[model samples]
Target: MTVAKLAAAPRTAVAPEPTGPVLSCAGLVKRFAQRTAVDGIGFQVDAGEIYGLLGPNGAGKTTTIKMVCGLLDADAGVVTIGGRPLAELSVRALVGYVPQDIALYPDLTARENLAFLGRLYGLRAGLLDERIAEALELTGLSDRDKDRVEAYSGGMKRRLNIAAGLLHHPKLLVLDEPTVGVDPQSRHAILERVQALGDSGMAVVYTTHYMEEADRVCDRVGIIDRGRLIAEGTKRQLVSRLGEKDRIDLVASGDLQALAASMRGVTGVESAAAAADRVHVVAADGRSVLPDLVEAAERSGATLTSVEVSEADLESVFLNLTGTALRE
Candidate 1:
């Protein structure tokens, strides 16, 4: 569901001058009970940029966004938008936050839903109607604007959720796992819209567990885990962090963790970690290490279906840094 963090705030009459990064935050930390949920995570998103917070679930993606949206105060550090502190009520209105869950009214038609939420942000008659039509078209729901939310498919509902987020035309949009369970086609549509938003100069913070999603839609990605940001860069730059290393993927069954452990003992392998259905290994020499890896897998009682070797990629970077897969 959308948090509507900005919906109730008083709107500012003038947009901030775009002279710097549209959103910037640093040294953000948050803790609950005895455990830290977000630890010293920081990044900046300029206008016309899509910055993805790449991480597995509970890696503090949601918690960090909450602080950024001013839904939760940071235990330390600060967040600024367009060079203005988030503590200012007027500045909060400049953020559009679309949460992972759906928040539309089931009985309302798509047009009605937009009209309702649009008014919550102080939109007026003519402008509200125009924004409703625009948001529906932007989300590819203009053809179904008269359809009730209850009758729409899962993907359609997800898209409408995004439309509701755009009514205010905020400078920055924070999307938390926006494509979690949609069909492939709808997911594709959503990604296209996100890319379009970036091209049109909206600073977006997108968070997801899917590595491919991060690779496809994000301009730069920040890999976060265990409440800390481990790495941040573009796809090519992040991959370069693995410098000259080759990655091997062994798709197999049975005791994958043991197989990974066995590979870790091999001379050439730099690292190994087991994930669902496979084990990932990095080495200086990919082809030459295959024989040793096969023997190790056999000794671990694992059955190999296929094996592949390639230069380092985003997956390789994650495996190298965390000793775990992206979906772990």
Candidate 2:
């Protein structure tokens, strides 16, 4: 598989503008034997929207993603792309999926791998070369296309895997943990390209357990846990819905209960509770009330070790709703 002359691609066929959501799923459920891997998961992703499925490992993010991509059958639910049910084989062509695992032949050069995969997507010889070149360029791998996959860095392979997914120019892209196990630099590069694609009117469903990744990249987020979608909204909307304010972690030795009591008495504090060696405080204004909390702690004979204050964010919202951390 070789492109002797990599010329500029001819005018690529652009997917038609979506009249409705690019992807929609309702009451999606999947079970493997006795365990239900996905339960009642539903969401919508519009053209140019990057919807993130945020959950920890085994939280059914991947299972839900598979169902959305039509790669796995759902036990119950309906998925529609562009107002058509997923049962239509032709509609499946509207989606490009990149699984968590790298899907590439180790011995094949980047160009060779893409050429082979493009053919599988039914791209003809002339259009195939153009698509491959465009995909490589989008993934920042144009210069390395001649190199074998075995010689590419983990990040490069990840990017190349993404490039292959884009070869046929699917309107909706589903990526499962695209940055997992990648170096920070490469992860940033991959994320940048995903953002670019979203900007170019491609709908994207991205799944990740990394809190910061979801926060940084997603236009809206669906928080899934125990195989259920607990919440879905923009970060701001989710946090606002939970009524979370600033969160402060007051760490001290002595009696944490006493520290918590003091914190609870602070005027701006919305709530305070003692968990282990720390006192968690929610306040309308954390910084403004920190001085008072410190004084109260000192008066209660609790020596303050450290104090951390952060405005309301997805982490706090997740903790409030699920009673656990997002990564856990």
Candidate 3:
């Protein structure tokens, strides 16, 4: 779908000259007493781009976001929104934030909630009403604007939450796990809305642990872990980091650990690990490496029942880099 047809406004404003990145963060660090939350992270989000921060729980994604929004002070590092430091309140006014948890009043109607938030952003009178209507229509909630938030379905509530964020026409939108706990239909709608926002020239920083969501929605992704960025690239680029390593899954009966060790020493094998009934092997090339894998298994007294060779994917890349599965 075209962005102009989806968004309520034009993609960007006409500038006297091309400016620097829409958003830039460098050496961003956040600490809570003795524990470090965000560890010197850095990245940039250009206009009309959707940058995803992906990691498991407690990877400091939320903490990094909080610091960027000025909801929390950074122990060190710098955050700039539209070339201005985040310490500048004016820059904060230009950002739209959607938190992980629902922040609206449950007893209020969707329209009421949007009006309240719009007023907080200094919108008023006819202009505020017009913006609220535009947001409701954009999020497919125009017909349900008078429904109380608590009476709305999970998906509807999420859509309204997003609409509230857009009411002030912020230049940058930061979404923190916006699709969590929603049904598949709701997730799809949310993603479509996010893509529309990005296409309309609003820079976005999306955080989620869902690999599939990140792969589908983000223009580029930064994979953070334990407060450190371990990988950053497009989905294809990140998967390509596994370079020449084809993954093979073998299910067999025998000493799995011993078989895994033997497979690791194979000529073309790069790494191997055993988990329960399955043995995972990464090889230079699966086609040629299969024969050697079988031989290695036989030598280890494994009665191989099945073997499968799959091309390297993001999951495998995550496993290889972190020594743990992304979903774990």
Structural similarity to truth (TM-score) of each candidate:
0.94, 0.82, 0.84
Residues 49-110, candidate 1, lDDT per residue (tens digit)?
99999888889999999999999999998899999999987787688889898888899999
Number of the candidate with higher TM-score, 1 or 3:
1
Which lDDT values do the candidates have, in the order given? 0.88, 0.83, 0.83
Top TM-score hit: 1
The ten-residue window of minimal lDDT in model 1 covers 1-10
Q: Residue-wise lDDT of candidate 2 within 117-225, one digit each (tens)?
A: 8887778888898888878877778999999999999999999989888888787899999998999999998888888778777899999988788898999999999
Mind giving the per-residue lDDT tens digits that candidate 3 earns over 1-328? 4346445453222111126787899998888889888899999998899999988889999998888888999889998887888887767767889999889999999999999998888788887888888888888888988989999999888888888888877777999999988999999989998998898888899999887888889999998888988888888898888886788889988898888888878897777777668787777789998999999998999999899998886556666776544553
Q: Rank the candidate models, highest TM-score first.
A: 1, 3, 2
Candidate 2 has a TM-score of 0.82
What's model 2's lDDT at 14? 39
Backbone clash tally for model 1? 1
RMSD of each: 4.2, 5.3, 4.1
TM-score preference between candidates 1 and 2, better one: 1
Candidate 3: worst-modelled 10 consecutive residues by lDDT = 9-18
